[model samples]
Target: MSKIIALSGTKNGVISIRKINEPYGPGSGTVASVGISLSGESENPEWKVHIPLDNLDEVIKALSELK
Candidate 1:
């Protein structure tokens, strides 16, 4: 099975960061992804974001500033 590394667990949800090592196989592929996952409630839905490593800092900053 493919390996998945979980950096931390949170009450809100969890964040996963995977480091990609290539040549992964035949076709071209991504280098890495930073993800933010949220659990669904009765009215909401579960979702995950596959964020580019370069944009992670900006995204995190924006999220942190949310009120």
Candidate 2:
């Protein structure tokens, strides 16, 4: 797994994009995932979104289509 990017939020938090293992087993067909995670203080829960490596291209395209 590799990290694509890491950025600090203006308010208070850390955001990162990384390559991670697929949540399901390897047999699930997707071996890797490009995901986003946001981490904050102990009082706040973190959030994450993991896009399968295979679907990354489409996902990126769709998001980029937005303003």
Quick one: best lDDT, which candidate?
Answer: 2
Identify the runs in model 2 with alpha carbons over 4 angstroms from their true place.
Answer: 1-10, 22-45
Candidate 2, residues 17-66, lDDT tens digits: the string is 54545457776544333333354332232655667778888888998999
The lDDT per prediction is 0.48, 0.53
List ranges where model 1 is wrong by over 4 Å: 1-46
Give the per-residue lDDT digits (tens) of candidate 1, residues 1-67.
1233333554455445555443246553544444455541312324433455566678879989995
For candidate 2, the C-alpha RMSD (Å) to the true structure equals 4.5
Q: How close is candidate 1 to the true structure, as a TM-score?
A: 0.36
- Give, for candidate 1, the lowest lDDT window spanning 10 residues: 40-49
Q: How many clashes in each structure?
A: 0, 0
